[model samples]
Target: MNQCLAKKVSLQILLVDSYDIALNATAQLVKTQYPDGNIISTRTANDAINKIVNWQPDLIIMDIYLPEKLGEIAQTKTGLDFLQQVMQKYPKLNIFVQSPYVKRLVQIKPAIVKHQGGFVIADKNVTSQEMLSIIDGALKGFTRIKGITDIYIYPDIYEKLNLKPEILKLLSLAFNEGLQDKAIAAHICVSERTVRKHWETLQAALGIDCHELRNQGINIRVFTKIRARAAGLID
Candidate 1:
């Protein structure tokens, strides 16, 4: 590998884990990819926050089960709250969550989406190569958290968006099943007029205007499908 391009001029990496073995092992693996990296390890959320505020590391590899302070029992909620705080304060910070309870991340899906930085997750049991690859990907601004199917929207906001089940079904049938509007109407036992109405409603709910799309020389259906998928309204 070209050292210059691969290493990115030596990154500042922060490893946050209360376990000495996990922290040291991750730092060693990071050294293999970034030989000249400045790696810092912190065992508690307070120390991690202090290091992050002071050093502003390029990447943060953290565990979900972490303690808030020395001599405190590590809890998933503590780490999660700390992670959320960090993401809020440094919206563009690259974060790599190396944890076994990756599923619990679904709770903060909304904030993750709003983050303008690299956010990647991997199970703690992944192979060294896989973990390194994910870390590399995070450095390159990749957001890949596998098995996370939904992005949580607030209940009131979701209701205000007016995303009804029929609208979601329409999106799935139109995009997933590859059906035309007419065919979608037939499949759902609705009239073509009602199907057209559904399309108009869906477009409005998604904040997509058909006229605006036409003005921009864009395909409305295609754009809608892309937007729906981005919003987690469809597969």
Candidate 2:
């Protein structure tokens, strides 16, 4: 709840990327969009962290793979590590994360959402207009963007969760598209009863009770979608 975000006044923004061209291009784009905004660009996680501590920017647009040197080592810290540090220190700061690897974004998204701060994730190839739209929405306190959420999937999640492919498919169909059990069964070429059996198995495997989530004021479908993404089944 930064007042600047609500008031739409002059803002401070930090842009962090390893690539010079992308970093400059994004900074220029932000300057064009918010003429009064102060834009600071950095190419390493260490520099970005230093700027975060000293400048305390209102918004940060950063890559997810900033490989930076530490002490004698050539490369030590990662952008995800930087992100965790930033979140721990500035829980309310808005952050926009861009990465070429969609799976990495998916892996980190749940943590970002759990922080309950302003956050958006998009591919590095996102159009300038789309990037601006995402920035505008995030500044207005929108935590999730359709463009990002629609394509998020952590590829290693299923293996990590030890989930069966069949169950994963069912969850993806149901959560991703809001399909009912019967519709899911139709889509998978199975009987509704079979779908129900698989659903029960899946619940046991995930150790999630839909009723409990409902009582916690969580939408079952949305919760399932998060789980699906976490399990790398969103595709």
Which structure among the candidates has the greatest lDDT?
1
How would you encode candidate 1's per-residue C-alpha lDDT over 1-235 as one tens digit per residue? 6876866666899999989999989988999888878999999999999999999999999997899999999977688889999999999999999887666565566788788899999888999999999998999889987645434322232453344447656766888689988899998889989889888776776678799889999999889877665555553
Q: Backbone clashes per model, in order? A: 0, 0
Cα RMSD (angstroms) for every candidate in the order listed = 14.0, 13.5
Q: Could you give me the TM-score of model 2 versus the true structure?
A: 0.58
Model 2 residue 231 distance off true place after TM-score fit, in angstroms: 6.6
lDDT of 1 at 150: 38
Per-residue lDDT tens digits for candidate 2, residues 1-235, read 6885755656989998877898989998998899878899988888888999998888999886676643322221266668878888888889887766445444345566667568877887889998899898777766864444655443334344344447756875786577898899999898999888776665544456888987999886666566655543443
Cα lDDT, all candidates:
0.81, 0.71
- lDDT value for model 1: 0.81
